[model samples]
Target chain A: MANYLKLYPIPEDYRFHRGGQISQGLLAYETWGTLNEDQSNALLILTGLSADSHAARHGEHDTAGWWDYMIGPGKAIDTDQWFVICASSLGSCKGSTGPCSPNPKTGQPYRFDFPDLCLEDIANTSVLLCQSLGIEQLQAVIGPSMGGMSALALILNHKNYTRHLVHIASGMASPPFSTAIRSLQREAILKDENFNQGYYSATNWPEEGMKFARKIGMLSYRSAKEWNDRFPRSLKKVPQHPFGIEFPVESYLEHHANQFIHKFDPISYLYLSRAMDWFNGHQYGTPRGANPLNDISLHSALVVGAETDLLFPVDLQRELHHLLLDSGVDSELIVTDSIQGHDAFLVDQQTFSQLVGDYLSASAV
Target chain B: MANYLKLYPIPEDYRFHRGGQISQGLLAYETWGTLNEDQSNALLILTGLSADSHAARHGEHDTAGWWDYMIGPGKAIDTDQWFVICASSLGSCKGSTGPCSPNPKTGQPYRFDFPDLCLEDIANTSVLLCQSLGIEQLQAVIGPSMGGMSALALILNHKNYTRHLVHIASGMASPPFSTAIRSLQREAILKDENFNQGYYSATNWPEEGMKFARKIGMLSYRSAKEWNDRFPRSLKKVPQHPFGIEFPVESYLEHHANQFIHKFDPISYLYLSRAMDWFNGHQYGTPRGANPLNDISLHSALVVGAETDLLFPVDLQRELHHLLLDSGVDSELIVTDSIQGHDAFLVDQQTFSQLVGDYLSASAV
Candidate 1:
């Protein structure tokens, strides 16, 4: 299993405006494959909501990232050929400096007092992670969903570091659907009696609230047609469970909610979900004043979307692709015909693998 | 204002396998305009989730149904020539027998004790209302979303009553997306501390749960792209809002949630959402087994879908139309381009009105 080691006192002053502030922090990350001597064969992957740095093959038994389908050796990302690194994002719970982490000043969970994070904070932390690993340039920075947002931020904010950017099922900024979903999730947490206005004790946590939040998210991650086809009102002869959720679809959601409650931290889920809602291209300064895309020179950019992805639809991906093309950047837009919805980038391995493999191979030259 | 003289009681003999029993009840509904002496100029309008018999005309002001655009004097249903009757379903809050209604025997709210209601219950109640009103038959039965399901049920269960069926942004039964979304809404209600396992006190009811439930419904009711287009990370001028929700979309949801909490009954919302999840054609003893269309006998059927409807997509509606045609039934399908999404049936009146007018006029001869 991958282990964690924390470096004391980050030298950089961390600035935030969401009430609580952290002067310094450490990052927890994991790596796969091996770095080449030239350090040019490196790829940094970003994670979506409720994900970790376990990008690929964290354990001897072949434990990989949430997107293990696209990141393994001989897989789409082909870790055997290129070194891959992933880090738990800021404001996330997976061994990262987040709301559940001990506050540097108080030595207690930051709780609601944790500073609100933007895509910039996530990109800044990833930059530090790259520096800590002694890597000056990344061959490609790739991410899906919120990770996609972070990847865009990385390329736009630190143009010199990321040569190629691959953002799948994401947007240039936080869209209304993302914000609406996040708002509901946050409200679910805030309204929980045990939440105590984000000050709940460790023992009596808001498990139900977290479950509800996950259920809400599960709806957005998949498409309606897929659900209609997968679990069409056929009453499976399985005896009615005690949960009153008799349908296969209901059972699926229940299972997902239960799994999320067990694996995810309630506070961290809230903070990260909110972080995704806060992502905006305008945060780098007004687009009216500065041409951020014009400033960033990318060797190549690949934007991929799933046909049924209701969260970041193909239209939004097209918007991003058009923006890159308008900026005179080399870019290719591909829409994956998958019913897996927004999670298609992770679930539809064969299609996603082809896209990623082709993009990586083309960008490498 | 429409008022009922006597509230019908659920019969005590009825029993449900889901550990609850629904009392058999009757609904009193009224109509506007004149029913031609031939009784062929009557239109039956079904209500959406949490809607009431007040489908149109709130007062003598001649207000229209929730679908004012398609149900007015010169519009689709053509109230100028057709008598329109909108009835509240049996298990509803607005002057209908529901979980919130007092049990005749126990003299207390039914709570979880309310019997599980299938689509048949709504159709059955509507049939009885039609019979009491002395309408021999309906020229057309129309509804949107859940109302669409009810309309389908009316045609399938009461074949001879309705000559034409118009279902918009809905299908024969509840799809997995509906089940998943409804389950989340149910979870929201169940997780509320004040819910008291559906026996919540009348004073401090589960308002937060209702808000959360409404928010979940709202997400499915609109398209993700529409949300992005309408509320693109543009910060609202409102100063009191926090970071993650500083966008207009967040504010829109907050306002929507608050409105839902104030106007909608929490227990009723849970009941309706659950009923929608439990809707299955197989449960109703339909002769065609899993496929309700095989047994449906209608003079004509018109199915409409909103281009951006995420909950009930155009493809689903198309499938239903195909099924109707495959079953040798006369059917027409139309896709309305509307940013309002699933709620487009209520919002995009002009387009839908024209479609309905053309279809109804063609069927009249």
Candidate 2:
């Protein structure tokens, strides 16, 4: 099980884009394995859009982590050999200071008043977490998907504490395709009459809107081939289900929507997707003025991509590799053939695990 | 506009699966260019899902037909030389007898009473159309997407009709991916609260449901990359638009849906999608079963695929080519590199027109 501890900063002037301010704030994080003397073997993992710090462990049920395959003993990440830490990013819902978190002034959930956050804020808070844990430096930093973007921000914007980087299915900045999908998903949520301008009452959450948004997202997360193979034209025996959707695929979508609503916060999804859309290297003070490939120092990096990933696509990976090579960085690119698409990193565990293991063992960290 | 006159005693009876009978229906068709005395210069063009018999013409408005680029004079199909005829398929919303047509027996629209159609019905009707025009054989039958499927069916079931075939972004039969997408679109309509269970009154149609269905179809019709390029994340400076969607892409979808609802029939969409799913060579009494290559006499065929076509990937085209070769059919396979996805046949008109033109001219009846 993964647990969180909140660290509050001293009162300081914090201004927000939406004409709001927070005097002080609490940051939430979780840790795994054990910190050794000298604190140089720590590895930090950032999470994706709806994920929390509970990346690798189930609570009291003795269940596995969201990324259990990569963090077990003798695994790719090797939890037993190195101390690992993951944090519930700011503006997120899981044990973090976000829209669902209680406001210090009002004693109620911030909701709409939650300030906008960027990757730099996340990286800065992570640095605080490391300092609080008495760690002076990190051996490596790794993340997947959006988490990978966060890791890149930490490596590029923050000091060179991390000696090695492993970013999978991420890019230097948000591509137009990602922005378009996010924009549509956001529209799906906001256009719902039930959204009520993002001020829904506690009892009447916009479940339908959130489900529609998730359905749109599910389209991008998996390959068309996988969908075809898993749920064919075969209709349910009943022909006409109570929901009026006859095909098994519609039922599968409904099931997927329900699960997402149960596990994720609608507001968090909105904020994270927006943050991803707003991600620009130039905004974070990149020397090349937003050209991601032009302004990064990578001592050693491994970039992995999924061949069937329509969302990220292999072209993005190839672009990232070319950028790294042009920047005179020692970077390796690997493409994994999987029908899982964007979710291949999570679903195709064996191949991903082996790829990460081989890359880490071979790299000079 | 190329108008179709209703003719009685359509050469054959359309045998439906549900034991319903539609007897003696006539399909009006138009031909371009000159057919030689031996009737060897005939080229049969198949209509798409909702297209009409007016495939191409030199109309006063200069609006052109749906496939004018491929069938006009000096264009592909070469109106200057080959006699090209495009006929509306049976059970289509456009000019064809469909669910919206009035039932002589009940003095009302067929609606739910319309017979469930199969691919054979479409092919058989096409054969009837050909016979009415005094044509016993075709130089080639060319179609794109659904039209492509119909072309393959024509040669497989009616061996004496088409000697050459060209199928673009189509398959031997509908794959599970196509079926699943169509099923989802169907479910979107059927699940609409106002659907009236496919029994809407003549005056009160479920336009919202139909629009949603079209929106879903549009999503699959184009590639994600194309969408990204076309609709970047540019916020409208003035947010006071009556339409609530903020993003241009969202607005585009709304507009597309509304236009489709105005011109397309909901019942016809459902029927056509179902017919596509039910396409099987075995069901049509073909010797080699549903596999197009297994039991058909294909003299020379040209198969074209769009590089970004998600509905029918290039790999599927390759599979068809391999199958044809293995079955001793002379097949020429060419993949069109376009970002238009399944709709590439329409967008990449110049290249496709040339391909179809060369293929049709080289294969003389």
Candidate 3:
């Protein structure tokens, strides 16, 4: 790992896709391996809802990235061969410019006042970051879930500049069912008295509501079959709870929900979640049943889906594969045999590695 | 239609299985058709979480019940042949005594002070109600979802006293996955600021929390396939809300959630939901791998399940069917073919009525 963990400050004139421009915004990113002589080996990696730039552990920041397993040396996106630059979403709270960040004009946290963000903004900003990094006309891009949406947006804008594309567990837009779930999650957060309409005090956060929202998100992330398999229909030895959460599965969700409060920003969650819901491939003028990457000089692309995924179901992935092939884009689709569902990209690392490893390392970029 | 929407009060000293004792308690009920000269054709119908005694129209109230489609004169239960009586579950707010009712001694609402309830209590209370109605035996018992659990409990205790059983979209106990979902619903209710430790004013209900919980429940009641088929991924033409909900599905859920607040009771939801989680078939001492209805003269049992139901997956229903057959009970398990899922029993009235009508009308008390 060379000139790692860096920030690219975006100037004010570089306005947002929607209204309310950020005078001074920044993108947090971490790069692993050398950027090769021509910089063509650099792979831009994007993340899911709350994932960070730290795609893998490096030096003192010892904390691992959300996609830790996939980006390590000798792993799927081998650091020894490909220069990896994993950038956290522009509106995420993980060191990126977001709701919790200070407003340049007011010098106060933007909170709900933060500029409206969309998927395209994140994708476009990352491309600009690549340009700033002096990486000319370069490498492959890998994204999962929201990251996949951003990858599509990136290729749609910078068509010929990008090569290979790997989109996993995402689609043309957030489906109606998923959008409904997200809206309910936002409702939960908004109903919390402490949420204070997205201006809850940093100290007295809407922890309860945020935790509940995370729990709801967890249901969509994994499938019912996985939960049934992991947690049996038996009571915990501890005497029954007066609150009625004596089952192992309930306990598991509570534990995870608790952990989520400290790490996730409620306002950022609202912004990013809304950003994902607002995204649609048609916004880029891509016609229905038409491939978004057809005009690109992309070498080969891989569209991955989890068979049990309820969020971005496998059917959408199959559609994407067919669309890509019809567009004259060299592409392969892999429906991973996984019960982890939409989260297969994170949980079923082995299958993802098996399906995507050869392709990322196939020397296209 | 005969006597309708009557309340039967229970004297003090009546104790519950979990804890505490309710002194002045009541069970609300409604009946249809004649009980016959011998009182031998009296039928008892139990209910799910939020169901009321108005299982079908009877007198002054005139409004139909949740299962109205299958409970009229020539419907599935056939009021012309058998006297039909549907009683509200003990912990429900529709009519029965619950947490919202005042404490007999304190003159204040029971709130959290209300005694913990279990599924067996609902079963036992209905039996007592039958006895009060001067009926020596129940000709038949029809139960759906949680009502099905109570039905199993009822047969386990009454043995030969009850003649037939029709259980739909339910099982011996709440599965781990369903339990987990219910637990989350409870968490949402508890997390609500206005829940006020379950002491929110009757007029100022914990509307927000209850509505959010209902939205979560609506997800489990139906399958993803049904949602997809019902709500397409098309965007609403009103430009787009800056805050994101631009889909018609969002509008549908928001509308339903708003309606839910006016009807469902938050405290009743919490207490009754726990009642379901606490219920296990083994509590009645039915040996493992042994059918709880075996020791009785159950003429036949029709176990119906939905093909797409996610809450009570069809697998459990299959197991119950096999167990009934093994125990020598003349059981006919009819798995309903529908995309409506757990709510299929409520929505797919034609299919349920067809499967149950033939069996209920085939014999007599």
Candidate 4:
């Protein structure tokens, strides 16, 4: 595979949001289009829980990025008019420093020794990367799912850092339902014998645990309606064993889970998932006796939610829009009738691209 | 604990619906009130997947039954006016002949050697129990959740077995989304090292797998709205370990899972859950070139569903009602606004009791 990923080394002794410091820290990213003379066209794209920095392809030989359909030169993000930068989250395995990364002092994987990761840390590091790139101010910041939480952290931590915000399928903080599902996913991994307290080797990896966790994640990420329409209750084949797959839906989940078990690092997944549960947006303004989103200083904002999003239900996005307006920011909320759930933004390109494309065009300064 | 459970023995070798024979078969059940002279006032109550035959308390020392609130004298079921019989399904562990039972021929637990138990078998055994009790006719048959599916099987297979039907929170067949969730749950247990291919000993039971499966089951049994109301985004305590319970919801799931792990047999759960996935009501009617429900001789039927039910959504019940009406049976559909989800019929007594009581009273012959 041709490498399109770029890395930025942070200055020594970088601090994290929760506590502690890392001797070595790095952020993996990719950029497209041109940084204008005044650097005002810069737009930062943050991603969901498992996404990496490769948001889109840069060359014909490059493997397709996670969001390649929506981020190219003439796509929804439109690199022709905007200098877009997409960064892998700090506590991730996609060419970034995480639990899987080696500790400079010990010459061993940080594993649980890595400091507590927060969406705040991801927001902070991405901002530092922006500064290092000589971009003093951002024209806009686009965040979807977990990335939306990081975007909130970015603007709240550094007021007026961006002019516009595009928040999709995310909330101010995690809800109890999502929290329960995530907790179970983590338990599946930690209880695996092969996990061995984070000392799992390549040959004896926690494959079963990771596959189970990913299956649970897939259940929450997509909508019931989509599955009903796609797989129905049709039998795939006669089951010879008691617990074997019989329905097409079960087979679909197995395929997806097997593909994901080895692609992502288990320890990193644990850290990032916990970070989402710990985030409380109310802390941002509770001390001031107001809504937590009271300080986001964007000139305008566009919030997008889907009717079928079970993980981050559309109501959370509605709440986000309400808070943004109360905080005195010009905000618009769009609730699409997409049937693909929280993952609709990734695959429902026609609807999402037009919605996002129109909003960016209208927000041009 | 005092045993309020009663048992009935099958005469000799009994054939199963899916091609197997049991040398010894027994059904555990409980009854309230008395059978009338003609047995026309006898009513049969079927239960969900995990429930036993103890629908309510018969004595002061007897433990409260799973549906004690709505099954006693002057309650919704009004046992004073009707004799009510509730039977544990044949493939269950609650005092019923199941995989946990010893095979009469080999003096060993049937385990995987047991026949493939279907809802049809449950319906057949319950009907035989009714016959042994000298009941020629029934006033009504009430089934909730899995019991509702068995009720359909009973009326479809026996034809005119009951004069009226009350079905709650069930469907004609399991939907794809539910099949996916149930498949993952079974995988959780089957993947447990301690499970040991159904030969798991008491000392080395698949406790972790069972607990995990129960947690997933709980997620589907209840509604997100109820969880949001009961356990909000409040932190229970600061998580000391990475995967420890951090949110109130996570703690709630853990508590419930621990209480359920050893209460039910894991192998029985696997069989009952798979039976639900394999059922197709259409199969009954396809051979005759008509609706499967066309043979059901009920004078009236009441179908109850909750808007919040994720496992068996309201739409399924609506389809059931439509099918019953199309098959020439008088039917009414009630979509309750209760936030209790699929388990609402067990907990939301006020709504369910009134709905059922009204139907039975009107249909009294």
Arranged by DockQ with the best first, the candidates are: 4, 1, 3, 2
Quick one: best DockQ, which candidate? 4
Against the true structure, what is model 2's DockQ?
0.31
TM-score for the A-chain in each candidate structure:
0.92, 0.90, 0.94, 0.98
lDDT score, candidate 2, position A57: 58
Q: TM-score of the A chain in candidate 1?
A: 0.92
How do the residues A276-351 of candidate 2 rate in per-residue lDDT, one tens digit apiece? 7656543544553444545555577888999888777887777777777876778899998888999999999999
Docking class of 2: acceptable
Off by over 4 Å in 4: A1-3, B1-3, B287-290
- Fnat, model 1, is 0.86
Per-residue lDDT of candidate 1, residues A1-365 (tens digit): 45522332343565653434575576777777788998998899888877788766644585555777777777778878888888888888877778888887888888767777776778877887777777889999998899998888887778889889899999877678877777777777666678876677668888777777777778889888678778857765353532266678877887888887758777888777777766766455445735447777788899999988877878778878877887788999998789999888778878988989999988888
Once superposed on the true structure, which residue ranges of model 1 sit more than 4 Å away at CA? A3-9, A14-24, A58-62, A236-243, A282-291, B3-26, B58-64, B237-245, B282-291
How high is the DockQ of candidate 1? 0.62
**Scored by CA lDDT, what does every candidate get?**
0.75, 0.72, 0.81, 0.88
Docking class of 4: medium
The CA lDDT at B338 in model 4 is 92
Q: Pick the candidate with the highest TM-score.
A: 4
User: Poorest 10 consecutive residues of model 1 chain B by lDDT?
Assistant: B1-10
Q: What is the lDDT of residue A266 in candidate 1?
A: 76
Where model 3 places Cα greater than 4 Å from the true spot, the runs are A1-3, A59-61, A134-139, A237-245, A282-299, A361-365, B1-3, B11-14, B36-42, B59-61, B134-137, B237-246, B282-297, B361-365
